[model samples]
Target: MAQVYLSLGSNIDRERHIRAGLDALAREFGNLSVSRVFESEAVGFDGDNFYNLVVGLHTDLPVGQLAARLREIEDANGRVRGGAKFSARTLDIDVLTYDDLVGEFDGVKLPRGEIVKNAFVLQPLAELAPQHRHPLTGKTFAKMWDDYDKDRQKLWPVHFPWP
Candidate 1:
């Protein structure tokens, strides 16, 4: 099985969608390493705040197939596609890393760029897998988060109790 990390976020009906997303992930992946959910202002567009977190799991599926399955889960939870790139979302899920694989496999980029660019992604990811090094940068997630400018984006941990 390959170790995979995923980023999940939602703005519309935030709590409900996030809970549903986690439920689907657990059902499909058997077990999940979840991070504490953070609420942050929407980046790139004007909208409601989003609840974001990272999840780690073991999967036997290939990269393309895993991405497809995630998309299905989002759709099942009312994810609207073909909208503006950063519009409000019912549920958003993206593959963050597939093991230590680098480059675009099956059109999904490993070590997703957002990991370093956004506090919502990096903070939770670091909390989940602090020692895991970036496939390209070779820097630990904790280190990256430490060096990131916390002021660039605002995010805070919320009271999220999950299974």
Candidate 2:
């Protein structure tokens, strides 16, 4: 099974959306390691605070199929398509990485550049895969967490339970 990492977030009814997304993922992958919940300001565009978390899962599904499943989960949680990429949503799930494979995803790219530059992504990624190295940069999540500092000014712990 490929070890895949997923980042989950929402600003619209953030807690509920995040919880639903986590349940969907648990059913899809059977098992997963989820990171602590964090509250971060909207990445782009203006919106309410986003409750975000990252998950590490082991599954045999191909990257494309996995990405599709993530999108489905978001849709199930009331997400709409065709908005400004960062517009407010009920759910947003992004595939950050799939094992060591890295390439331009026909549908959704793995390890999207934003994952590396964003602390919300990095912090949970470090929690789940501290030792896994980035495909292009060859730096472990923990190491990168130490080296990089994105706009963390707005990121705060929600202390919301992880599933």
Candidate 3:
């Protein structure tokens, strides 16, 4: 089984969607290593704050199939398509990385660019897989986070309990 990391976020009915998303992930993947949920102002758009977190799992499915499954979960939770690039989302999930593979596969970019650009994605990822090195950069997630400019964005952990 290949190790996969995923980023999940929600703004509309934040708590409900996040919980549902996590539940779906657990049901589909069997087990999940999840990080603390952080609340942060929406980036790249004007909207309600979002609750974001990262999850790690082991899956035997191919990258394309995994991406498709995640999209299904998001859609089931009311995710809309063909909207503005960044907008209010009931549920959003992206494939962050698939093992140590580099470049794009099955149209999903490995080591997603947002991993380095977005605090919501990187922070939880760093916390969950601090020692896992980036497939391309070869730097540990913890190291990249340490070097990240925390001032670029503001995010804080909230009380998010999961089963």
TM-scores for every predicted model: 0.99, 0.94, 0.99
Number of clashing pairs per prediction, in order = 0, 1, 0
Tell me which of candidates 1 and 2 scores higher on TM-score. 1
CA error at residue 23 for candidate 1, angstroms = 0.4
Tell me the tens digit of each residue's lDDT in model 1 across 26-123: 99999999999999999999999999999999999999999999999999999889978989999999999999998889998887999889999999
**What Cα-based lDDT does every candidate model obtain?**
0.95, 0.83, 0.95
TM-score of 3: 0.99
Instruction: List candidate 2 stretches off by more than 4 Å.
Output: 150-153
Question: Could you tell me the lDDT of residue 17 within candidate 3?
Answer: 97
Would you list the clashing residue pairs of candidate 1? none
Displacement of residue 125 (Cα, Å) in model 3 is 0.4
**Model 2: per-residue Cα lDDT over 53-160, one tens digit each:** 888889988877888888888888888999787799899898888888777766776677877778888888887789989988999988998887555545767778
Candidate 1 stretches with Cα past 4 Å from truth are none
lDDT of 1 at 66: 96
Prediction 2 global C-alpha lDDT = 0.83
